[model samples]
Target: MSNCSFCQVIDETLRPGGIAIWLMKEAKEDIKYQVPFLLAVYLDENVYNGALNFNPWRWMEPENEEKRNRRTSPFYAPFGGGARFCPGAELARFYIALFFYYFETTYR
Candidate 1:
């Protein structure tokens, strides 16, 4: 149940032979679909906090473009990635954050 797309590599439940699509660095310009791109790198310093902190501002700060890039950087894809990415991903994140906010504040 990890939120990282990189963690998907260590996930054992995905179907075998399943292929993920992505835009490669040097993909053929003529055929966009043919581009070979798929990845994850959540452990990077700028990507995640190494499970050390839960500062939502790392992602929610309006002036921090670098931190915001993490949203679409494939380092964290609670919804999904590539063309198959969920359109409601942001809404889903909002609900999840809401749930956590209430659960933490109320249950505490």
Candidate 2:
């Protein structure tokens, strides 16, 4: 995913809680809430070095790409994750790519 996509995922304040409401398994107290995964992880300094800053070049590093290949990588999901992954992920990416192509080619 591009840096724009990452930013969108991390900075979506409209969905302050998250994309979905989840209910936990049986416990002493019932808890239901939206787990804003990207936003939460993005705030953690230890996770992505200077995660607060927008550094597109970070994605180019071999270590970052390798982390992406791992299913457990916390920062890998631009379109959400697991069984509830977004259905429009591919279409969204295509549009973003198309826009980026034009922007990069046409910009001064």
Candidate of highest lDDT: 2
The deviation in Å at residue 91 for candidate 2 is: 1.5
Q: Clash pairs of candidate 2?
A: none
- TM-score between model 1 and native: 0.38
For residues 1-108, what per-residue lDDT tens digits would candidate 1 score against the true structure? 233533232221121111333443554555535443333333344545542433433443343334233235444443346665677755655565567568768994
In candidate 2, how many clashes are counted? 0
lDDT of 2 at 82: 71
Candidate 2 lDDT for residue 95? 72
lDDT for every model? 0.41, 0.51
**How many Å off is the CA of 60 in candidate 1?**
7.5
- Tell me the lDDT of candidate 1: 0.41
Clashes of each: 0, 0
Could you give candidate 2's per-residue lDDT for residues 10-91 as a string of tens digits?
A: 3332122334333233457767655454666644666666766665555556766654431344555545667756788666
